[model samples]
Target: MKRPNFIVIMTDQQRWDHLGCYGNPVLRTPNIDAIAAAGQRLDRFYVANPICQPNRACLATGQLSTVNGCRQNGIPLSPGQVTYAEVLRAAGWRTALIGKAHFQNVTDVPAPSRQAAGKGDDLPASVALARREQRDGPDYLNEVRAAWAANPDRTVPLPYYGFEYLRLCIGHGDQVEGHYSRWLRDRCPEAVDLRGPDHALDDPAVRVAQCWQTALPEDCYPTAYVAEEAEAYLRSCRADEPFLLVLSFPDPHHPFTPPGRYWDLYDPAEVELPASFGDAVNRRNDLPDALRQAYRMGDEDPHSYWPFHLFEPELRRIIALNYGAITMVDDAVGRVMRTLSEVGLDDDTVVCFTSDHGDYMGDHGTVLKMGLHYQSVIRVPFLWRDTAQRRQPGVSRVQASAIDFAPTILQRAGLRVPVGMQGEDIFAAPPDRPVLIEDPGIGVFRDPDSRSALISLVHDDWRLSLLEGCMDWGELYDLGADPNETTNLWFDPEVAGRKTELLLRLAERQLALRDLSLCPTARA
Candidate 1:
C-alpha cells in the first residue's frame, strides 16, 4: 500500500458561512461545496485563537499558542520547536508551502542600526502637519500621518518557516511592496512607482494598483500563481513517495481588493446583511477600540461613541466583496482538484480544507478579524476527504480544533504524532469527547481595560463557557436550543449546579492536558 499524498488548502480571514454548503445563499463556493459533498464535513470546527500567526503556528506544530510561544501575530515560532514539516521531511515526505505563511523573523537588530538616518527624520513632522490640514475634511488624514510617522528602520527578513518551497508576504497586503519592493523595483523599474503624493501611499486601492503594474508572472500576484504552481506539483508527484503541500491563500484578508472580474462576480444588492449586523452590543466586552480602529471598525478613543450601526450598508458591501474573493479562491481549488483527477492522483490523495481562523464578516458590528469569539471569527470550516480504505467518509457533528489537523495528517501518512502535541488523533478517536476552545485574556487593540479570557467545553447538547480576567460573565448554552448562542443561562440559579459540573469537567480536562495558561483567576 502506498502512502496518501496530503493537500491542505487554507484561506485567510475566511468565515464558515461564506461557503454555499454552509447555508450561505449569495456565495458560490462550488469547489469547496463539492469537497464537502464528497468528503466528511465536521459541523463544529474551531481555532485556538482568532488571529493569524498564532493559529497558523498551532496548525503547523499541533500545539497551543502558549506552548509554541507564538501567542501573537508578530511573534516568531521558536527555533527549537518541532514542526510537522520537520517530522515529514525526516520521514522522506517532500514538503512545500506555497503562499502566505505569516511566519515571523527572530533576528535581533543592533542599537546603532535602530538609530535614525537620512531625511526620514523630517517625514513625520511634515506628515503630521498635512494630517492636521485634512482633519476637517472627507479624507482620513491620520492614515497618511501614520505612514509618514513610520520608522524607516523596520525591516523583516524572509523564510521564517522551514519550507522548501515558499512565497509569502511579511505583513499586510499593502505592505507586500516593502518586502518585495526592492526586488520588484529592480526587475521592473519603469513599471513600478512608489513615489506619489503623500495621500496616494495611504490609499489601499492605489497601493494595490502599484503592485499589479510592477509584478511579474510569478510575483504579479503570488497567491493566485502559487495555486497554479501547487497544482502542477500535485500533478507531477508519484504515489510511492508521500508529500505534504500547504496551499495558503492571502485573499479575502484585506484591502477588499480582488481581480476586476471577481469584484464584478457578485451583486451588492443581492447580498444579505448578517443577522447581528450593525448591532451596538458592548464592544468593550469583546474587543478593544484600537484593534477595531486598526481594521477601520470604529473610532480612536476607547470610550468615544462611533456610529457602527450606520456602516451596515457599506459593511454588507464589504462582506459581499469578500464572498466574491472566496469564490475566486474556490475556483482555484476546483482547478487543483481537476488537475489531481487528470493526473490520476485524486483517489490516492488525502484532501483537507480549512482556514487559519475566520473573519468577523460584519458579525457583531465588526468587519475583519481581531477580537471576539463569536462563531464568526473562531469557528472555521473543516472538511477532510479520506481516499484511504481504512478511513470512513461520513460527516460528524463533533467539535474539533485546528490542533487536531496535524496529528490527523500524520496519522493518515502512517507517521507518529510527536510526544508534545496537545490535540488528539481526531480521526482515530470516537466522536464522544467534548471539544474545548480557549481565548487569551488580552485584546490586541483598543479598550485595554476590558481584558477577558474564555474556556469553553462543548458537548452534543450543551456548551459551557468559563470566562475570567476582566469580566466575570459565564455562559451556558443549550446548543440544541440556541445554535446562535443568543441566550446566556449562566445566571439561572436552577442550572447553577449543571454549570458547576461542566466547569469542573473543563478544569479537569485542562489540568490533565497541562494547559496551565488557561487556569482560572482566583475569582473565577
Candidate 2:
C-alpha cells in the first residue's frame, strides 16, 4: 500500500475564535469551515507555548520548548534535535517546508542585541538616534542601524531541518520582506540598486512594494504563496514515493495588514465583541499592570499598535479583520485541497491545520500572546483530516496541545516518534486523557522577569494553574461554570480543598509527562 501523503498548514498567530466554524459570524472562512465540517475539530486544543519560535520548535521536534532548546522566540532549535521531517525522510517520504518556519534565530550581521547592550547611551549618535526613532519613523536610519548591529554569524542559506524546498521569512512579521531585501541587495548589487530615488531606504512603502515584487509573484502573499508552493510540490510528487509538505503562513500575526480587499470584507459595525470584552477580570490580584496596559491599547486600537490592550469595541474590529485574514488563508487552503483532489491524492492524504500560537483578541484585557495561562493565548484550533478513514465528524473536548501534533503526524505516517518525544498520539490515546500546558516565561527580546512561568492542568471540569515562582497573584477558574474565565476562585477559602486536589493532580500530570521541573507552591 502507498503511504498517505501529509500536508500540514500552519498559520502564525491565529486565534481559534476567528474562524466562522468556531462561532465567529463575521468570518468568511468557507474553505476552513468546510474542512472542519468534514473532519473532527478539537475544540479544547492548545499550544505548548504562546510565542512563535518555541511553539514551532515544539511542533518540529515533538518536544516541549525546554527539551527542544528553543525556550523563546530568538532561540533556535538545537541542531541535534530530531524533526518530524527527518522521521518522514527516513520513511522515504519527500519533505518540504514553505513559508514562515521560525525554527532558526534571526541572522544578525553586526549583532543588534550585542550592540544595543554594549553601546550604552554614549554609542555613536547615529545608533543612539536610531534607537530613539519610532518603528514607523520617517527615515530608515533605525533600520540601517539595526541591520549593522545584528549578529553576522546567524545567517543560514536555507530553512532549518531537512526541508528540501523552502520559501520562508527569517524573523518576525514586519522584518519578513526587509530580510530578503537585504539578502538580495547584498548578493546582486548591480541587479538591484539600493541607492537614490528607486532605493527602498528612501521610502519604507517602496521597500515593502519592492520586496513584494522581487521575492515572489503578485498573488504570492505569505499564506497564498506557501499554498501555491505546496501545491506545486504535491503535483511533482511521484506515486511511487509518498511526500510530506509543511505549509506555514505568516498571517493574522501582526501588522494585521491583509490586503485592502480582506480588510473591506467585514463590516466593523457588524462584528460582535467577545463576552469578556472590555471587562477587567481579577485585576486586583490576578492581573498585572503591564497586561492591563496591553488590554487597554488592544481595545483602543488593535490595528495601529504593536502591543495591544484589550478593548471591546476595538477588539471587535480587530477580530473582524482577523476573520478576514482567516478567510484569505482558507481560500489559499482551498486551492491546495483542490489540487490534491485534482491529482487524485485526496483519498490518500492526511491534512492537518493548526497555528504556531493564538492571539489574545481582547481576552482578559490582553491583545497579543503574553501573560500567564489564558484560554485565548493557550487554546488554539486543531483539526486533523484523515481521508483514508470514514470517521464521523464531530468536536472533541479533549485537551490537546501543540506537542501532540508531531507525534500524531509521525504515527499517522507510519513513522516512529523519537525516543525523547514528550507528546502522545491523541488518536491512539483514550478520549479521557488529561491535557497539560506549560508556560515557560514570555517577552521574546526582554528578560523573563517581565512575565511569569505557569503550568496548567485541565480535566473534565476543573482548570488549575501552578505558578512557577513568587507570584502572590494567581487565578483558578471553574471552566464548566465560567467558560469566559471572568472570575478567580484562587482566593476563595471555601474551595481550598479543591485547589489542593487540583494542584496535586497538576503535579502528578507533570511528573507523568516526565516534566520534573515543576514544583507546587503554597497559596499566598
- lDDT winner: 2
What tens-digit string does per-residue lDDT give for candidate 1 at 1-524?
Answer: 68787889998878887889888988998999988887888878888766777888888888888677776544566655678777877788878876666654311221111123356444554443422331122221111212322422233232234455554433333234322343435544542333222222234453321122112232344355656778778876887777788888877676555554665578878898767664555354443342334334333322121213226566656776687678878888988888888888788788889988886666666665554456777788998887746456667777678778788888877889887887777767767666666665334323323345556777666777655543346668876776666667878888888788887888776775664324455985
lDDT of 2 at 430: 66
Which tens-of-lDDT digit does each residue in 148-204 have in candidate 2? 225322333432476666555443332343234444334444423422223322234
- In order of appearance, the predictions have TM-scores of 0.76, 0.79
* Candidate 1: stretches off by over 4 Å: 105-162, 171-219, 283-297, 301-310, 388-393, 441-452, 515-524
Q: Given candidate 2, what's the lDDT at residue 8? A: 88
Considering only N, C-alpha and C atoms within 3 Å, which residue pairs clash in candidate 1?
288-446, 289-446, 290-446, 291-445
| Number of colliding residue pairs in model 1 | 4
Worst 10 residues of 2 by lDDT: 208-217
TM-score for predicted model 1 compared with the true structure: 0.76
